[model samples]
Target: MIELQMYINGEWKESSNHEKRPIVNPANGEVIAYAPEGTIKDAREAIDVARKTFDEGIWSDLPAVERASYLFKIAGKIEENQEELTRLETLDNGKTLREAGYDILDAAACFRYYAGLITKPDGQTYHVADPMQAMVVREPIGVCGLIVPWNYPLLMSVWKIAPALAAGNTIVFKPSEITPVTPKKLFEIMDEVGIPKGVANMVFGAGPVVGHEIAASSKVDMVSFTGGTKTGKHIMKMAADTMKKVSLELGGKSPNIIFADSDLETSVDYALFGIYSGAGQVCSAGSRILVEESVYDEFVNQFVERANEIKVGPGNDPDSEMGPLVSQQHLEKVLKYIEIGQQEGAKIAAGGNRIVSNGLETGYFVEPTVFVDVQQDMRIVQEEIFGPVVVIQKFKDEEEAIKLANDTDYGLAGAVFTNDGAKALRVIKKLRAGITWINAYHPTYNEAPWGGYKQSGIGRSLGTFGLEEFQEIKQININLQVEPIGWFANKNE
Candidate 1:
């Protein structure tokens, strides 16, 4: 098994407690690696290193173009190691190899996207009245504390890392203790690329210790977190003490509305892809599907038929269309939600049990589950299962569809599929989500902003907005006419 250590101050070091935790492969329940179980002390040290690095202007003082150059190099390195990284991500995250490959490509592209964005003319000059000149420039927000979730380990880390580094901020990053392998590999790449000392530090441990320290620390100027809503709320409270800038991308019970006018086959296919991809571990998983009532029965039948056909197996299996959940704990959580749906009087229209055949008993595999006849008030309909468990609701008309779709606490993402372009536009516009698609689901671009309108998130990521999250804006006002006119004294004289 591979042994991983924390990256701090440009060196790989053991945790202050000298304790290591086993990193398990969810596919086969094997201990694939060991990661340092960092303590609050180690977290404080990493934060201090990042703070000193930023305060010393070692990285933050670099020219914007110079910072872009480093990001470009890092992107090149990621592409160079794409295959290996993909394999490790699959092994660590328990996602299909194909999905992991996509993440690797996207991670590289994210770095390149930010690299190009940083060199562009970002400051704005205002046309002020007469002898006054005004402009706004963006600067790095000192040391950043970045916490990423376990689902998209490498890509999510890159989503925060690339932009933060591109904006010239040193960071103390914390990847989920559950899936630390690929992120550890990423830190190795940073070391090889010669990232300046203390510019980017990584700590590995439970969220309560390392994550808490990072969010609550006074030295960290900003905290960017992507995880469950509960944890995001906790981080907000923690950052509130120091008044640190906080950006959160939290949970979503996003909706995918399929109308009768849409291509039935394509809508069914995408509906399956929406929730089943990544085993529905995605934060923006379209777990809530609202169907036009006229076509609801037919769509439900076809969806169940296809969802049953999905090949569930280990990530290494080439034929596996969907892999296991990230861990046994998560598997249990998904199964528990499935049980809750049944207990809440929702009918199971598709697979709802664990996959134990074909020598997959040891792996954390659950069948793609679908529940029908679910009410908007049901817990399964409202809560984010974060697994391959979806609830399909029926709505009578366009108005009802929109109402059902927006009935959740989350407003992260939504989509409408219909042949009527005008109707699609109208419905999509009404979605209270940050990301909406007319006839698509789960396709996101690095060039566009990604976040939610409500509790789904507080700030956007992955575009120009993503870079600005780590930056502080300053307005500069200058008086071109320097001569001062005395109003009161001259009048008295």
Candidate 2:
């Protein structure tokens, strides 16, 4: 099995405690690799290194063009190793190779986007009423702690890393312990690109240990995390001790509102793609689908028909349309949610059991599931199952559709599928979400701002806003004329 080491302070080192955790391939329950299990001390050492690096200005003092050059080279290296990275991602995270390939491409694009963006003029000069000049300048926020989720390991890491590095912030990264393979490869690429020592470091371990240190340490100037809402809240509390900046991209139970006027076949296809992609482990998965009363029955029937056709198999299999869940523990969680859906009196309209046949029994596989007659208050509809399960609810009119979509505490993402452009626009305007799509489901762009309105997240990621998250804005004022007015009466006067 492949053995991985933690990248800390420019050194590839094992955990100080010499502990290792088996990295399992969820596809077949095989140990694919072993990763260093970092301890609190390892985490502290990385943080200290990052703090010193930021203080010394080894990277933060570099010119923007020089920083952009590093980002460009990192992007190039990622492109050069695309194929191997894709395979490693699939093996580590149990996603289809095609999906992993898309993530790899996007990660490269993210780095390139930030590289170009950083070279552009960012600060603003303002005209003042007095004879003084005023301007705002952006500077790095010292050391940053970046924590990413397991579902989109490399892509999520890039989402935080690209912008943070572009803004010239030193960082201590912590990837989910369950999926450390691709992240290790990413660190290798960064090292090969010759990033300055301590400018970027990574620790591998459980969240309560490594992640906690990153969040709680005073040396960390900011923490950006993408994970469950509950965990995001805990990070916020921990970061509060140091009064550090925090950006979160958290959980979602987003709605996909389908009106009768929508293209039926296309809507059905996107609906399936919306929930079943990544086996519904996506943070912004359309788990709650709201359909107009006129077409509720038709949409439900067509959606179930398509969900049943999705080929559930291993990520490496060429014919597999949908891969297994990320891990056996996650599989059990998904299964339990399915049972909860039934217990809450929602009708199971499609596959809901674990798939165990055709040599797939060893894998953590679950058939794509659908639920009907689901009420808004039911646990199945309100909570994020984070699996290949979706609930369909009927709406009487446009007003009801808006009400149903806004009912959730999560405001991460939502979509409206309809033929009438005006109606689609009108409904989307009312959605209490950060990311909204008209006639589309899951097409995210690096140029667009991403996050939520409410509990879905705090602040945003991607686009220009993403870079600002790692920066501190400062105002500078200068007197054009040297002479100062004697406002205060002097003793001689």
Candidate 3:
């Protein structure tokens, strides 16, 4: 078994209390690793060191070009360990190795993309009233606190870390308690890239302790979190004590609307890819599918057939299309949602039970579930199951579809499938979501802006918006005239 340690101040260290937790493989409930259960004192030390590093200007004061070079090197390090990291992620997070490979590639791309953009001059100069000029410049926001989720693990960590480092800020990060193995690998790469002491620190423990302390740290200038809505809200409340900048990317019960005019075969394929990808653990999975009344029956039949064909088993299996959930707790949660769906009178059109066969009896496996005749108000449709479960509801027209899609409290992501380009565009405009796709689902890029409206999240990540999240804006005013008109007692010089 691998032994994991927290990376802080450029060193791998055990918790002060020597507390540790076993890292279990959800595929077979094996103890694959043991990670430090860092405490509040450990979290404070990481934050303090990051604060000192930022204040010392070791990282935050570097020239943009110099910082970009470091980021480029870090990206290269990630690329070199791509294969190893992919397997480790599959072993730790229970995602298919194929999916893990895609995420690592994207993580590398994110670092490179941010590295290329960080050097470009930010802020603008404007000519104002006579003999005066105004300039708005962006600067790093000092120390940052980053909390990553268990679902995407390393990818989410990279999403926060790349931009923060590229923007010239030091950070103290906290990985999810359940899946800390891949993050340890990430710190190993960060060390290989020679990131300075305290510039990038991490702690592994429970959210209420390590995560909360990071958010509540006065030394941290900003907090960026990716997780559930409840935790995001609590982070907001805690960060408010210090008035720190907060950027959150939270949960989603996204809607995937399919019209009758859409390509039938293509729509069915996208729907399956939408929810079943990542075992439906993706935050932006289109869990609530709304199909037109004319083609509801046909679409449901083919979609069920496709879901049934999915090979669910250990992630390492080359033929396995869907892997086990991340843990036994999460598996139980998904199974409970399936029961709730049936209790609400929704018909199960596809698999909806625990998979206990083919040497998978001990694994946390739930078959991909599809529900039909689901009402918009049903808990199964409204709540985020975050599993391989999907709910299909019929819509009479575009108007009803829009209403149903916008019904949820979440406005993170949604997709529309139709042949008419104009109709697709129209539907896209009406959908109350931050990210919308015409015929595709869950295709996110490092070059584009991502986040959500309403409860789904606050602020945006990726693209220029993501870089700006770790930045603080300052406006500078210059007076060309040697003498200034006196507006107050000491106005004239």
Best by TM-score: 2
Worst ten-residue run, lDDT, model 3? 484-493
**Predicted candidate 1 versus true structure: per-residue lDDT over 279-339, tens digit per residue:** 9999888899899889999999999999999999999888999999988899899999999
lDDT (10s digit) by residue, model 3, range 1-493: 9979999999999998998899999899999998988999999999999999999999988888888898898889889999998999999999998999999999999999999999887889997867888999999999999999999889999999999999989999999999998889989988987888889999999999999899998898999999899899999999999999999999899999999999999999999999998999999999999999999999999999989999998888878899999999999999999999899899999999999989999999999999998887899988889999999999999999999999988999999999999989999999889999999998999989999988999999999999999999999988888695766787354
- Runs of candidate 1 exceeding 4 Å displacement: 485-493
Give the Å error, residue 266, model 2: 1.0
Mark the 10 consecutive residues where model 2 has the least summed lDDT.
484-493
Give the best candidate by lDDT. Answer: 2
**Candidate 3, residue 91: how far the Cα is off, in Å:** 0.2
Q: Residue 57's C-alpha lDDT in candidate 2?
A: 96
Range of the 10 consecutive residues with the lowest summed lDDT in candidate 1: 484-493
Where does candidate 3 clash, by residue pair? none
Supply candidate 2's per-residue lDDT for 238.
Answer: 99
TM-score per candidate: 0.98, 0.99, 0.98
Whose TM-score is higher: candidate 2's or candidate 3's? Answer: 2
| Backbone clash numbers for all candidates listed | 0, 0, 0
Backbone clash pairs for candidate 2 read none
Candidate 3 residue spans exceeding 4 A from truth: 488-493
